[model samples]
Target: DVRTTFKRMAMNDEETVALTAGGHTVGKCHGNGDASILGPKPEEADVEEQGFGWKNTQGKGHSEDTVSSGLEGAWSSKPDRWNHTYFHLLLNHEWESVKSPAGAWQWEPINMKEEDKPLDAHIPGVRRNPIMTDADMALKMDPEYRKISERFHNDPEYFGEVFARAWFKLTHRDLGPKSRYLGPDVPKEDLIWQDPLPTVDYTLSEVEIEDLKKKLLNSGLSQTELINTAWDSARTFRGSDYRGGANGARIRLAPQKDWVGNEPERLQKVLAKLEEIQQGLDKKVSIADLIVLGGSAAIEKAAENAGVKIKVPFSPGRGDATDEMTDAESFNDLEPIHDGFRNWVKKDYVVKPEELLLDRTQLMGLTAPEMTVLMGGMRVLGTNHGGAKHGVFTDKVGALTNDFFVNLTDMSYDWKPASDSHYNIVERKTGETKWTATRVDLVFGSNSILRSYAEVYAQDDNKEKFVKDFVKAWVKVMDADRFDVKK
Candidate 1:
């Protein structure tokens, strides 16, 4: 549990060891009293105690009588000082399992001298044996952790340095790129997990942007091809960790370029053309900006074909990151096995496809209505993975339209089961398949809340509203990880 939890937080073994030991060095656990007498949690307590939780009425209810984690005693002999006493006591002594007054199992040093024990927090002239929890003991017992523990014991200076860096990472990692960090205390060096990007060397004028868009459209790539490549590049963003987005242009790097969900062959073709266009221009433009620009241009063209004539918002200044800036191995966890937005599932899973869709949507920080609009728009724009026609409900496949929601809510078609993951929409009168569908496609019209959103797009007057909402959602996904670009 300790190893896995730390790994997800982007900590390595050495950092994990430093953080755990350094954190426990000064704090003493309080479990000297019976835990059964504790009051209800703050939220569940009476009106008077609403903001205060776990009140203990026994004795003074604090100090010597306090109970937390049901374990007692400190890890270091000199508990108030910043020293290597934790490493000293852990390595020098033999320990035995013992229970605190609260009945929780913990480890205590056996046959220890009186002077080596920690002084009681509240009582003068009283000393108690130092204690260790199961997690603390694991550092001494686990072979890999034991080696790191021994190193810290030998060199206190290196141990302190490592612990400080690890502490900084644990606190500031979710704050996005170091560019967003203000104040003088922020560190000078950039870490790989920060997903750092180079400063934008040049800015493009509006005329230059329009010229590049024209070149991208004339590069012989279809509207679906341009949009899908950009979507695939941007879809890896996780608002949770503030990592993986189009700003780094990491889609061209290893792991991501080679991901099966990205459709590598098609990706290479789009990138090749985009790079070629980039080489011909006199002004410098990052492939990161071009990729997003291509998508926006394609979206505008699609909306124009549908008679909406609205512009898809575009923002430039995204910088391309090199392979050295990327942690290739760490990115394996970010790969999409299933992307419900593009209507692709890499393999079968026990969970329903619609549920997987919701999971991905929430991770991208999108609301339910935004998810619905993006889904309907992607289907009509023919951006389904592998050119799978499962959800391409419109005859005008390359145009941005509300035809997906319209056909979905239309009563003339009967949906039949093609397989567990698929459904076929057949005409009720003639019994001929008009279009194929996936559970992800049918879900919007089937679920009550989603169906309500779907019905709004399906109405005659909301076609322009559908196009505008889809463009808004598309921009949100594209810029989800652009922390360097100011809001």
Candidate 2:
């Protein structure tokens, strides 16, 4: 249970042991009284209690009578001071299961010397056996943890250093890149989990950007390929932790490059061409920037084809991250198991596809309208995963048009389930399949909330609004992780 919890925090085994050991080195757990007499929690407490709860009524509520987690005693001899006594007693003594005064199951040192026992918090010169929770005992019981425990016990200095670093990571991990850190006390060293990217010394001009765009458009790559590659890179961003995004261009690195959802074959081909173009240029341009620029250029081309002349915004500061900067194992969680924007689900899930779409949309910090427009635009641009024609609702594929919403809200077609995850859009009269869709696509028409958004885009007057909103949403995803750029 402890291991699984640590894994969710993106912590390694060594980090996990260090954090737990370091935390327990000081501070004793309080369980002096029977916990059953404790009152409700602070939020649930009565108004007369003045927002304080866990009021122990069995005895004096203060000091020795307090009951919290109900796991009594300190893990170390010096409960108030930081020391190496935690591993010292943990590795040297045998422990047996015992009930705390509050009736919580805990482990206490068996026949431990009185001198080694920690003094009680309230009483003077009265010593008590050091205690350990099941979580603590697991350290010595597990083979791998025992080895680390022995190592820490033998080397206090090494243990201190490891714990210090682990604690720093646990606190600052959600801050995203080192650039986001403020104040004079921030550490100078870069951590791998920060998703480091090389700082670009040179910036590209509009002329230079235009020239690069021209090169990409004439490089024999299709609009779909360019757009998909860029989307895959940027779509990894999660607003929750600010961990993944286009800023590092880590999509070119391991784990991400090999991710099944990225369509590795197509990705490699696009990267090869982008790298070739980068090598030929005198000015330095990151592959990260090229990937996004290629997509912007593709969207612009696609928009022009649809009779709407527009320029998709492009930002050129994104840096290409090397494999060394990426944590490949930890990144497995960020993989696109179900990407509604691309109308792809890697595998069948118990959760409906439409729910998965909402989860992703919220993570990327997109509104319902933005999500709707992006899906509609992605369909017509032919960016579906593996070219699955599941959500391509437009006859004029490769063009940025409102055809997805137009055809989706059109009453002439009937949606029939082809299978659990697939649906066929058949002509009402002819009974001929005109287009195919996933729950992601049909949800816009079937769900009342989403259908309202779809109908707005389907209107003739709102065609231009759909394209503009799609471009705005597309740029939002591409630059989601660009913390260096001020909003």
Candidate 3:
């Protein structure tokens, strides 16, 4: 029956022609190893009778040498014959064990007739069966089995858990065999083993812990709930075999905000003091001396007052007086004294001390005594004098003592020659020192020292105080045993 169905479905017009030429036909009946041709016959006779017999013969003689040789040769002649034989073989093995009521060889029908008795009742070896066995039913009904099966078969989330659990067991071989079995108390959701318990020896203060809890609560987390959940998670991870105990727990404090504002203010104050000191000496001292003694406190005050920044150069003392003066030129020239005053003002004043000598012969353009007077005044005034040695009045008074004036009127009324001389006087006002020896000779007669003294003393109201202090200090030197006033 299978072969007849297959052949009808597989047959083509060209295949039919080949089968006819090879001495096979749609209706012909042939024995094993026999070839005979016949014409088309009635549909029922060709299909129901001849086709059915052909399928039966092919199924029973599939391994016979004679049947195999004949079929191969016929199949080559008609290509459809090979397909028909293959289909028949497939159907034959499926139906061979089927039985009939009479115990006769017969093909099983697709559908049973209404008059036919139930096949199981008539067939002695036939029996009805359930879909699954008792053992299979019991396993399916078991809660554990159902849970595992459902986990793998239905829920992808549960399937991932199972896979992870199995993967962990396989990889961590050191955990021992007892770790594999899932205990009754074990949560179905937490099937995988986690990383080992962290060796946490760090601790936090109770206040810090409470503050952390408050922060978490402020961030929309329930403090107690989160702690309970965390504890459960930690316990689940550690499990019953954990031996490290509560000593292994750790708590971390939150990071504090950094406070770096105004950290440099202390150093800034020191620098300000140094700048104040520096600015104060700008004009009074050489740039080299200013730098050497410019302390931090002085600089800081100067910088604050001037509203400007000041910095000391790395090299302070590598230049000549000219270089030092040039560097300090920008500062205000308000200082009362400076180291280089004489050299700085020499071009504007007298240069040589000997220029003060009085000789009538050398006085061509000017009187010789007048030249001496001008030089003597300059010496007293400290003009063009360098250092502390050049500006002393004792030396000038000693030099002028040679020309003594002896009054003929009264010996007591006689004055010293240097005191009578117009050149032996000095005048200082403001920040400049001037020698008035020449001016005194021209404006006030050299013979009248009273008029010059009266004019200067009237101009400077404090002149008497200056004279007293100067005389008091000078008398100490003049009164020394080494000096003779008469000389």
State which candidate has the highest lDDT: 1
Q: What is the C-alpha lDDT profile of model 1 across 195-237, one tens digit per residue?
A: 7888887978788888988998999999999999899999998
* Model 1 misplaced regions, further than 4 Å: 51-53, 484-487
**Model 2 lDDT tens row, 321-359:** 888888898898899899999988888899999999999
For residues 245-347, write the lDDT of model 3, one tens digit per residue: 1111110100100101111232233224323543653232222222222221122222233233433121112111222112122111111111121211212
For model 1, where is the 10-residue window of minimal lDDT? 478-487
TM for every model, in the order presented, reads 0.93, 0.94, 0.13
Evaluate model 1: give its TM-score. Answer: 0.93
lDDT of 2 at 393: 84
Top of the candidates by TM-score: 2
**lDDT, candidate 3, residue 274?**
28
- lDDT for every model? 0.91, 0.90, 0.26
